[model samples]
Target: MSESSRWTMPDMAGILSNKIPQDELKPGDHIYSWRNAYLYAHHGIYIGDGMVIHFTRAAGQEIGTGTVLDRFIFSSSPSHPSGSPCPRCGDQSRTEGVISSCLECFLCGGELYLFKYGVSPGVFIAKTRGGTCTIAPSDPPEHVLHRAKFLLQNGFGVYNIFKNNCEDFAIYCKTGLLVFTNVSVGRSGQATSFLAATTAIVSSPLRFLTTGVSGLAAVGFGVYCVSRYVSDIGVRRDVMKIPVERLILCPGPLESEATTITDTSKEKGL
Candidate 1:
């Protein structure tokens, strides 16, 4: 989220409406197919019907939408008139042209990423998914931890909700960079509030996007194209499905299981 980045809100919205046909795609959006499914423009293209084609880096599989973004956030260098530090990682890198948000950076640890909408710049709330333990890195004696709350993507649309309350903090010790990632919700009213917000987002989309018109139109045209870089590339592929005659799968079953003699010597008449 750089001021000069080309991939701004309005720009991405227009591209989405065009490629997927706004009406069909819908507002809240239900793109992901499943655990391993890659529905969004990043990995593949959603062509009219209930099908998508993805172009991937995997050799043979490089033909269509690639890996599933199981906790992946897309990243791209902002390509606006000027450049600034990334709001997400604060990386002071300069990008040219239209560096969209479709590409991802592993630096964020693949835990969170933007889908259709853009993540607002400011204090972010990052919640821990079920069964996932949160931890902060620390040196020997010192435990310097930075806490970022988690927000649930509920029906509220995308407003970046997460009550600001420092339930976690980091302090340095003689040992090392002592860190605290996930502090327990031990009857702390503030921590409970954040946890509730996180759940809301996971369950409700109407709520997350309820903020409406987050003011992303400021970024000009160049900033816009960058968001769809991955999608545009995904759409370029000729991943159209072939007819039944072209299928490589065999419909018939094996006549019977191949039987192997108990002793190879018996079969060979040794």
Candidate 2:
């Protein structure tokens, strides 16, 4: 294959593998670790000195859906198996909102993985799992670090699984983009995966065209992939780049206006 073709080809290895050693971690890097048997992933911003800034709910409140999801998300916070508070973090299991924790506490016994940004679309679609990578480009390390630290002091709004979660927090730190629509999913790929799976099952038009079960399944999978790709924050047009400081000052009204604009665009078929 030509060099250009090779570059465009799906990187199966990159898509499947994102593990990185601790020594490789740099300040301002976006990192995550799988939790709950890979059902979901917890994300954070690495801000050097073996510390990470992440957004999360208080213990026992990870998932605000008021369903069985709360059980699966129970271990999303920083806790040690020894049943003792982390010496460096100091019993943060109940702490909520943006807070800093040591890397060991953040991983919570899971393998370390780096979140990729500015990936090729082929590579993005090839990864069946979401929240692992994004097609959006990350800002400079300094900028990313600034955002993380700023949010750590300010806040990132409430913790909602489908809307504002850990993955959404990390993504916003890396990229200053935020979706305006309140009805839509945030930047978290895991949330997108959930919605896409639902869309594939219920809204896929391919059911009418396919007869065989295998063909139907294939069509559903295609729909799922397309849904994930288009819903990605990098690919969406409704996102607006807002400064972290301004977001902190007027988060409520700005989000309201953004939602209004999104609804208007949809009504006009944009």
Candidate 3:
């Protein structure tokens, strides 16, 4: 937590959006919103001009339009009346360029909107400070932005919570490599992890005695799964308990929605 070094989250929050001035946000920096300390629900890349680019599942047709294929949302502050909640905050705006409110995002999944506004409250923003997380060569900031823009131009594709998610997009932009973290969800995920470990342990000898290469391979795979789950579970529990005081925020040009935004907007009609 020193000025010279960057903060690292052992598991969730992956650095906890440690508050810093938004002015410090440069193109290619990662911004995220936490469902809580244990769960980072959204992530995007800052593309300057107060805009962020991130992959989302939210997409639809125009007023008279039908299904559309836009997944990457180019987001910014909404142009709502000053002091009023942003029109795009919930499901209010059907326009393709707004980030949906948390409620809407939770209900129908998220959409990628461009030009609509502000991140959800208590959302955290972060950027790589010194170097890259992996050995992948880090590009210059301009190059990073260009890469992000190029991906956005390609539009969004299928979203997979486990395989392809927001963090994968942001990290790819910054480091030119697709990466996935091992963090999972709450009780259900914990139960699955436990089951995976127990099955691996219980099936080892049986598989070794009864089957051939494929059976042994399954046991090996189980070993890998158990190790991964073991490492992740302890940290996951710790993160859920992290003190709120440890979170960081930036202090610079504040977006208008940052102050007045809430979870109430026009609901999506059937």
Candidate 4:
């Protein structure tokens, strides 16, 4: 593991899997980095001990040690099911989370839409597989925003379903802002609605997992994700730069000296 070049920091959440043997670690335990002794963070996982998996990142070369999460949650199935298909993405994406539980899909990246059927004007029952129901919409935008802030801060996917036909909402990730258009059942506005002035630089130390139109919408949202390395002063107050412990526990024997990892991405210095 070395300092990343493309990025200067590490951000994202969740790092562990069911196969890690929960007996070695449980929920609310400190995670340490095996590569860099100082790269450490706290997470909530551990169905037992030595078994925990959350979505996080490893050190990068060009990006300068940023998140590159490609993890599996179920330890029993450490290797992604081959031959089997991930008709969806969200459901197929799984890792562990300190505050999130099954937020995304364990199979496909497609989000699990929990839509309910309305039997009446004021009453409704969740027709989805989880037997859920709809609650009354928010009273005002401020209320919606406040609620959204809390949801996101608490490690939940903060989705603000505006109380109108417009499908517009702002997402506050632990890393950056996730704004989308046409994808939400809300209204349309410039990316400014979600992003503060360019100077605000709300580049929170959060990791983002985008899906569907959100990927396209992020460009419109104008949210920037700037990472800080271990040298950054006080950056750890908001969140740790890189989670070293999680990476050390990562399942992998270093690549053979003859092996060469390729940069398959289009981004520069990646």
Candidate 5:
């Protein structure tokens, strides 16, 4: 086949699959996958051993009620058969049982997994650079991972998409600060801004009465929209500036490199 023909061959990789080496991903490394063309998309933190802790909604779950769960980047085969056919994949066989499980996970708004065993999302993983949102962690990766696991164990169920989404969870795990840089985007941002402004106006009517209700509402909404737009753009630009050296975590030759490096650094007295 000609080089041109080879280039035309389909890249059948899953949507979450990438060429990132596994070793560089320390626990508490922020990982994200594109939910759409843009947005920080879905985010989670690596907790070693091909597992990640993230806030996710299962199917039929309401927002703000999403659970924080530990999920493997790859799914394990169901220990036993449910015997119930998955509506999405239409398979009831034992060998393909994990497919139904993964389908349910995805349908329920859980994290997408493209396991090392080669389960595809029926789509290629969109390209992404693995990077830290905050530079130079104040705490070590082990401590950060411990914090994440602590929260997971101690009911870290409070989830606000704009203020306390997955990104917020991951960042908080890495750094003690609870923040999501992209919190100023989309409906979540708009709603939050509007709420704060509106609450201020409502709480202190006389102070804001210089502008009538109509004018106040208009001004408040306008300010929020502009602020959200500016903040979102700024945060996105900053996030992109952070260098992403490793792939999200491909679980290959470098599988234990991050831990090894951390240990070596300790031994070196760095």
Candidate 6:
């Protein structure tokens, strides 16, 4: 594909398979790679120079839920199987919050895939998997790089698998959008997928209408797709554009901070 084609809106096949070679990567690109046998993906911002900045938990604490899931999720940071620090990144396995690592270490033996933004609603739903793309458009590369680098110097608050994770970090860097609802999940598509699956299985209306197992399965899948689509940051109305500096200085939760800022704006009537 030509350079322009690579950046164009992806076709159905391209959307289904979003992999891109390393040579195509540009600064401020959101990239991810599957980890733990495709159980989940680790996401980061490609800020040029073969380095990635991502949010992660400390080693052995990727899953913050403190359940059996932790055993399976595994740390998303760079780790060498031979118990040696990566020559370029230097033992970032235990690093938490926002940190930088070389592209090799970031991939950690996984295949690299580009994250798509500004996708059509049809395309977003057609993707059975969440976290691969979003309907929101990305900001300019310079803005994205600035956010990533700023977070690296400060922090992105704590890492919560459901509300805040690597995917959330990358999404924020790319779009500067943050969920302002305290009860809702963050912008992480992986987290949304898990919730959507549970919602589908437990509360799908199709369960009441369908008698056959196949019918029930079809209903559940439809519910799952709808759940994922509506909860997406791009589609949700509960998000706000917040400056990265404000997030760093806020002493309260992100949602609360956003609310306070909104109220202040209202008082000023600007």
- Give, for candidate 4, the lowest lDDT window spanning 10 residues: 10-19
After superposition, the stretches of candidate 4 with alpha carbons farther than 4 Å from their true spots are 1-22, 30-44, 47-270
Name the lDDT value of residue 90 in candidate 6.
89
* Residue pairs whose backbone atoms clash in candidate 2: none
> TM-scores across all candidates?
0.16, 0.92, 0.39, 0.18, 0.37, 0.89
Q: What's the lDDT of the predicted structure labeled candidate 1?
A: 0.23
- Local distance difference test values of all predictions, in order: 0.23, 0.88, 0.39, 0.23, 0.40, 0.87
Q: How do the residues 49-167 of candidate 3 rate in per-residue lDDT, one tens digit apiece?
A: 66666655433221111223222232222223343445445333333321323322322233322111122111211211111122233456776676667666654334444444554
The parts of candidate 2 lying over 4 Å away from their true place are 8-10, 256-270
The TM-score of predicted model 4 comes to: 0.18
Model 2 whole-model lDDT (C-alpha atoms): 0.88
Select the stronger candidate by TM-score from 2 and 3: 2
Give the RMSD in angstroms, all C-alphas superposed, for model 3.
Answer: 18.8
- List the lowest-lDDT window of 10 residues for candidate 6: 3-12
Question: What are the per-residue Cα lDDT tens digits for candidate 2 across 239-262?
Answer: 988899989998788877787788
Q: What ordering of candidates by TM-score runs from best to worst?
A: 2, 6, 3, 5, 4, 1
Better of 2 and 6 by lDDT: 2
Task: Give each prediction's root-mean-square deviation over alpha carbons.
Answer: 25.2, 2.3, 18.8, 23.7, 15.6, 4.6
| Top of the candidates by lDDT | 2
- TM-score head-to-head 1 vs 3, winner: 3
| Candidate 6 whole-model C-alpha lDDT, 0 to 1 | 0.87
Cα error of candidate 3 at position 260, Å: 53
